[model samples]
Each structure stands twice: as structure tokens, then as C-alpha cells.
Target: MERERESVSAMFGAVPEAAGMARDVLREALEKWEVRKGADDAALVLTELVTNAIRHGTTISVRVVRERDDALRLEVADGSRDLPRPRTASTEDEDGRGMLIVTALALDWGVRPFLGGKTVFALLKVG
Candidate 1:
């Protein structure tokens, strides 16, 4: 939370509550940044990203940056070497639809390799 005015970020433990916490932080950031568009989609994307991080990796950190006047980038970094893959889920499946939801909401999303792990980022236009 001590980051720049155009950005807000938080680190989270690998817990179930991490998704909710990240979503709250993301909503606050969107409001503070005066971003009206894609607020709900951004929160949904953030939740999926955080949940995936908690489920698949450790040392999770969520960051939101005001990329431009019409764009915001949501980033979730985790201690995982394996990148995310969108999988097909059936009607009776209990899980494994995170990336599908993310893909449906985000304008763009990708992964970046880091020293210890990787950072997954989703771009949302918040005009």
C-alpha cells in the first residue's frame, strides 16, 4: 500500500482468504484511481489471479498499476516456475476454470519469468 499514487500492491500468504483480500484491494485502487469502466471485471480478474496464485504457488503478491488514462494492469506474482494453462472444465467439475474466467474478462494477460518465480499479469482498460 506504500507504493506510488498511481499504483497499489499487497503481499499475501498462501491462504484461502487471499482472493478476497486481493479483490478488496483492487476495488479500492480502482475507486481511488477514478476508474469507472471495467471495475467489476477487474475485481473478477483479480480474484481469479489471486486464487490461482494461492492454489498453485507461494509468496503471492498482487499489484495494480495505472498504466495509462484508459488502462490498468493487474499483476499477481507467485513462487511458481510453471506457467498457467487454460483447461476445459465440465459442468460437474468443482474447479479448474480460473484461467477461462480470466480470459473472458481481461483485455490481455500474460506471464513473465523472474529470478525465483514468475509474474502473471492481466490488462484491463479502466477508462
Candidate 2:
């Protein structure tokens, strides 16, 4: 059976609920795309991106697009123009490992300017 492709976009406040909402959106998108492998990893990345936007940016938006080639692209846009960097962290550090995990798991990922802000995206291969 051919899998159906879909896309979803949302904008939310820089609040705690936004992360949960982003996760929910990702879950729905993944289900629609029938891509189960590494879904948890994707969810984690979504949370990290949303949380970073809420914490560091004045506004945030998320977009999930499923390509005809069976690739799922997840993008998180925020008001901040600064690009994200995955830095080495001390074992004792409470945070700073989110982007590292993304870089490790995503098939491909990067950042780009969007609507006077910046958007970080990850492309995940789906079946």
C-alpha cells in the first residue's frame, strides 16, 4: 500500500504547553507518514527545538512536511537570528545536549533564515 503524505504547521506562544503541543503535532505527522523508526528521537528533537525557541525567542513556529520521496522534514522557526550550535558538554552539566542529539540522529539538518527569523530543520527518511 502506498503511504499517504501530509504537512502541518503551527505557531505557539513561548510557553511550556508549546513543547507538548509540538510533540503532539509530530506524533500525528509521523503516524500519518507511517514512519515509526526513530520516532522517539524525532519527538525529542522537536521538544528541544520548541523549548529553545520558547526560552530564547519571542515567537516560534513549527512545520512538518512529508515529501514524495518518503522523507519527513521537520522545521522549527523562531524569532532569534542566531543559529544553533551543538557544543560539547560536561557530564555534570544540566543541559546543552539537545542539538547534539539531533545532529546524531537526523539524516540531514540545517538552519536557514525565515520571515525575519530563523528556521532549523531536520530531514528524516520514512518508509
Candidate 3:
């Protein structure tokens, strides 16, 4: 038997507002797929990923996928080949905490090289 799956994707401009926009879209998509358990965590992760992409790339694309067991996967693709480095941030730092939050929340997360840039993905075991 095969597991059922649902996916939603979109592209957003490389602007400050993109993160909020991505969160809205992700929330809608997750709700449609009945993924409520990890929705808040997913939103936080999405905000971090989308914000990082906007800071480094010109165009960003977001993707969310849900499996039959309710595990959720979120990805943010940017138009830059620069790889993501997860690092610890100091309390005084104004930024550089995105990946830290992602690392703490995601079941697993990594990057994959794509055509123009790379895709950073986080998986959450919602089930």
C-alpha cells in the first residue's frame, strides 16, 4: 500500500514582507491538509527559512508536503548557491538565530542543491 500525500508550493519576492506572506500561505495549506498538530512550529520554521532566503537570494520558493501519517516537510528554495550553515547565536546578536530555531524544532533539516540554488528543508514528525 502507498501512503497519501499533499503538497503546496509558491514563489515570493525577496522582500521583508515575504516571510509573513509565506507564513500565511503555509498556514492555509496546512489547514487544508488537516495538519494542525505541528502548525505553529511549522510556521516558525517557515518564517526563519523564508527570511534567510530573502536575505541571501533574489527570489524564493516555498513548499510544504504532508504524508499519510501526518509528518510534514517544509522547504524554502532560494536563487543563490550559497549553502546554509547552522551555528549558535549569542544572546546579544540581533540575527543569526533562524537556523538555531529550526534545528531545535525540526525533526530533521538539511539542504539540497537545485538548478540555480539550493533548497533548505525541515521535516516534522507530526504524527
Measured by TM-score, the strongest candidate is 3
lDDT digits (tens) for residues 41-123 of candidate 3: 99999999999999985889999888656588999999899887788778898988899899999999999998889999999
Q: Give the TM-score of candidate 1.
A: 0.91
- Candidate 3: residue 41 Cα off by (Å): 0.4
lDDT of 1 by residue, 8-124 (tens): 989999899999989889888877877788888888889888888898748799999988877889999999888997999999999889999989888899999899889999998
Please give the ranking of all candidate structures by TM-score, highest first, separated by commas. 3, 1, 2
TM-score of each: 0.91, 0.87, 0.92
Q: Which ten-residue region of model 2 has the weakest summed lDDT?
A: 64-73
Please tell me which predicted candidate would have the highest lDDT against the true structure. Answer: 3
In model 3, where do residues sit more than 4 Å from their true spots?
Answer: 1-3
Ordered by lDDT, highest first, the candidates read 3, 1, 2
So what's the TM-score on candidate 3? 0.92
Candidate 2: segments with Cα more than 4 A from true spot? 1-5
TM-score of 2: 0.87
lDDT at residue 111 of model 2 (Cα atoms): 94
